[model samples]
Target chain A: MGMPLELNTMIVTKGREKRVEENLFVLVKEGYRLYPIDIPIDVKKTMDSDSSGSAVIKKVEWENSSTTITYQLVSLNSTN
Target chain B: MGMPLELNTMIVTKGREKRVEENLFVLVKEGYRLYPIDIPIDVKKTMDSDSSGSAVIKKVEWENSSTTITYQLVSLNSTN
Candidate 1:
């Protein structure tokens, strides 16, 4: 099987405290949506983090499904 | 269309400070693997969080793709 094609990804390096509506729009702008109550959001987040780990917020669209969107957002992991 | 079949979801409500190796095993035990570096881990973490928010680890397997697992683990969001 081919790797899950990443249609898009957005990193929120600034403004972790922004409104949830704004954070949600970030995904809408990128042509993606939230992954729903299931799926592992934590693992997906780790994938987006850089070595410094300032990065947060991710939106992904799988290749096979046009309707399924993977929207992820983390509030700049406090450990950083 | 039917909802993305949730094959399995595991929640870890304790031991957030354990080693990464241990975390990886947590998923393996649940028959799940961490999603690649393109999915949203942050959002997944939030999904795992209960109203009290002590939960951290998550492991999920998609029904469509057995090999494609969604394993997530957050270090107990500090705010919680």
Candidate 2:
């Protein structure tokens, strides 16, 4: 049998992201999801929200039925 | 060129693990490494140490030249 996994092309933080360092942020979500590493992806506050910035996913961790991702903001669509 | 990756069959915590919940732990280490997910693997305090327990890796994340892993301890070899 195969494990259920989701391949994501963008991030939907939903206002639950923590800044670990300058331009680097971490977010945890509920489920087994995968994202392309070391590649730039769009970051949105919510799925329906506009693209807030572009980020490169550095790490993606799945544990306890949850997914944690670490990303670096490379470019912002808006400063506000 | 292909990315430099290491496939690891066991976990070497080096005493740097933090408990996330009962029987669940998180460990961060240097460099990008891969582990068998959803399967039990040996856990050790160090590369030269004996197996402390068996754990099932739930998640593995690589970012910023570092690797982060989350696993659940299934059995411990010692009580101490």
Best by DockQ: 2
Model 1's DockQ?
Answer: 0.02
Report residue A17 deviation for candidate 1 (angstroms): 50
The TM-score that candidate 2 achieves is 0.59
All candidates: TM-score: 0.20, 0.59
Give the alpha carbon lDDT tens digit for every residue of B1-80 in model 1. Answer: 32242332333324333334643423222222234332323322333564222223232332223323233344435552
Candidate 2 lDDT tens digits, A1-80: 43566768899989999999999999998877767678788999988889999999888777777788989999999656
Fnat of candidate 2, please? 0.58
Report lDDT (Cα) of residue A28, candidate 1: 23
Off by over 4 Å in 2: B1-36, B40-55, B64-80
**Chain B vs. true chain B: TM-score for each candidate?**
0.24, 0.90
Q: What share of the true interface contacts does candidate 1 keep?
A: 0.00
Candidate 2: count the clashes.
0
The alpha-carbon RMSD over the true interface for every model, in angstroms, is 11.3, 2.7
- Relative to the unseen true structure, what is the C-alpha lDDT of residue B27 in candidate 2, on a scale of 0 to 100? 93
